[model samples]
Target: MHQDLITLKKICKPIENDLKEFQLEFDNALSSEVRLINSISKYIIKNRGKNIRPILTILSSRLCGEPTPNSYRAAAMMELLHIATLIHDDVVDDATLRRGRPSINKVWKNKLSVLMGDFILSKALINMVRLNDFDALKQISTTAEKLSAGEILQIEKSITRTMTESIYFDMINQKTASLIATSCELGAITTSKLEEDRQSTHSFGQYLGMAFQIKDDLFDILGNESDTGKNSGGDVKKNMWTLPLIFSKNNMTRSQYRLLNKLLNKKRKDGHILKKIYHMVEETGGIDYAKNKLDDFSNRAIDSISSYPNSVIKQSLVDLVGFNVNRVK
Candidate 1:
């Protein structure tokens, strides 16, 4: 993880100072008169994850042209929306941990967690309105819709056990990729009004996010809690068969399929069963298959920005592809 940050250090340097300001704005945006809200907001500020979304926003702006005065504000809104989703996600998943700390839901219980998520969403929307960029507003609003719809879709698939390759792609695209795509689009529009550049950056973000989510899913199966800073295989425990599991199931023999299905149903929550499942996934090339897909998307993302002239910012965007796909956490 330290090495991962090192790889992105050059990438993030271009916007490092701006990101600091953005962080301050992010913290300030959460301020409220209410007592519990302030406490929860402070906790969120303290335990925030890497501000990758906002950095991406700033870098995407630099890649196209000079960012507007509202660039960081747009970036802050992105982070706010992301944090809100995470707050809600923990409650829905009943997750006990986030970034290796006790989750908001765990510490404050479901009611406060859900309300905090709502508060963040309201703040993001209010900030978006203040920005007064109709196009960017539309982009982010569409993203908010996708995020909610995607989770519902994933939960439905998990409940019905009807997740196909196509549905899986759509789920990840909406749940993870849409906001990233919006981040890039917002940046480009804030910097340059050129529709072509905006579209191009949005595509870059979408492809990059696809790879990013799949890589995360890979970690969900293979990573340690200490390394990933979250519950490993929690998705599987909830019957959310991600790419690796889906591919591995496809490769199983009749008896093996029966065994795996039975184990997943009976022992999905069992940590002991995961080592065996991981081994089976590896032996059957499930991990290899997902890695291939990840590589494909990473390359696609790079290609999306290839038209941009060589520059520090361009190289940073390129480096981000490697950083995201290679990150273990």
Candidate 2:
């Protein structure tokens, strides 16, 4: 993972100077609130995330034309929105750790964490309004709504035994892909005048985002919890039916299905039965099926960007899809 981040840094070097400006912009945007809230917000920023979404925004903008103020603002907005979601996600997952550290809710109380999330999200909108870009505002607002809807859908489906592939796609599209699409669209809107270019960028982001989420689902089943900074088999433990579990369950015998149902419905605190179910998912072709789906999405992402004039930035975007799908952790 260290080496991978290094490689990503090398790839993003061209935009390094611009990213610095964005960091400053983001820092300046965070106002000094009451001492406790300010401290919590600063703590959240100190444990900085990967900043992948913002990188995508900047890189996509560079792919189309020179980096502009709008690109930086958009990147900052994307990062703020992403951080807000992470804060909320930790609460929903009852997650104790994030990015290999204690989560905000774990360190502080849940109420404080929730309010911090709201603050960050409000700051993002305030920045967008400052940009005075109506289209950007509309796109981000729509994506935020979709993200909330996706979360609700996932919560609604949690613990259910029969999650269809289509429903899974829908859930991921709203939860993960919508923000990515907005990032790319915002990038294109910054530079490109043609409607087709903007549409293509949006499509590219959507495909890449889908591929990214599918890969993440695969990793949860097969990856090291220590490396991913997430508890392995969390989906199973929470009785949340992901794609792999769904595919594996479809192939189970009636007796196996009964065991699976019993396991999912179990009220036990310990996760022994859930571990067995994860092993079952591995034994079946669940992980393999997800890999194939990831490949399909990656290919679609490549196709979406094929129309762009060949440039280093465009090539980097293509390479990023490959990286996202093949990431082991």
Candidate 3:
């Protein structure tokens, strides 16, 4: 009775051909005169993950009306900005792997990685100008700003180890949801140019992104390397406490809280550290609470676009929500 991403991808086949259009724009955006940069860019392209942002852009455009050329341009800009952020994030985290491969920062070292990220950002800006859509440009620029602020805030919180529920939501909203929200808004504006339509799609994107990020956080604690393509308890290593651990902290017994705090300060997974954290978090109902929130946010995302007319694209967006709910990887 449940459909996975493979099924959802099949359902969204309407967007398949247009995805090629997005790829062309993306390839053009990353093409550089510098040979080294071009090689790195090609490598990045070859190892790219799911183009969820662009897919959202295309689907949102169709849900509102017919997608336009500007939609592809906007999608390219969003993805470029996203890749730039990921490159910088890897450097900041000193991450060695990304999507199961050596990160650019890991392969090329910090200096070139940093410069490559800047180059991608500059290209995104150039593409934004070429799009000639002032509204889309504004949304994307604001999202770019939000991404930086979110990472800084998360870093600050991780060091202090004092993240509250409100703070966590705000952090994820900026870091994850902002671009998704803007992606849908850009799509809507590209097709309709209507304020209400754009707002609806933006809301849909924000809520879906919220659920998406919560799923990622869950995977940090519960997933295996084979499933997540990363080490288990990576968040713990990073000193970042996600929603489940934080909520559990709030409800933990005094002895449990102190022990948890001490373990977190160690910031290294020795024998049984992760198992202890998981046991304590589950005892306090944090995982269930987070799951409830995931459902709540996914429902809101669904409601946001429920008013749209019946169409396969709309159904595909709905299927995406279902896929997010049931996703294991």
Assess each prediction's global lDDT (C-alpha) against the native.
Answer: 0.89, 0.82, 0.87
lDDT of 2 by residue, 1-329 (tens): 48668767776777898789788878877776579977887898899877888888888888777778888988999999999999988887888878788899988878987888898898998899987878788889999999999878887887454568888899999999999988888888877735776788899999999998888787666665688887766766677778888887888788888877887777662556656767777787788888888899999999998987888788888878877875655
Better of 1 and 3 by lDDT: 1
What is the C-alpha local distance difference test score of candidate 1?
0.89
TM, every model: 0.97, 0.95, 0.96
Clashes in predicted model 3: 0
lDDT per residue, candidate 3, 62-111, as tens digits?
Answer: 88888888999999988998899999988888877687788888788999
Which residue segments of model 2 deviate by more than 4 Å?
A: 159-162, 268-272
Error at 155, model 1, angstroms: 1.2
Tell me each candidate's RMSD, in Å, in order.
1.3, 1.7, 1.9
Residue lDDT tens for model 1, 1-329: 48877887777888878788787777778889999899988899889888889988999988888877678899999999999999999998898889999998888999998999999999999889988889888888889999999999999999898898889999999999999988988888888879988999999999999999999989988998999988998887878979998898888788887877877887436678888778888888899999999999999999999999999898998989999887878
Candidate 2: Cα lDDT at 63: 76
Best by lDDT: 1
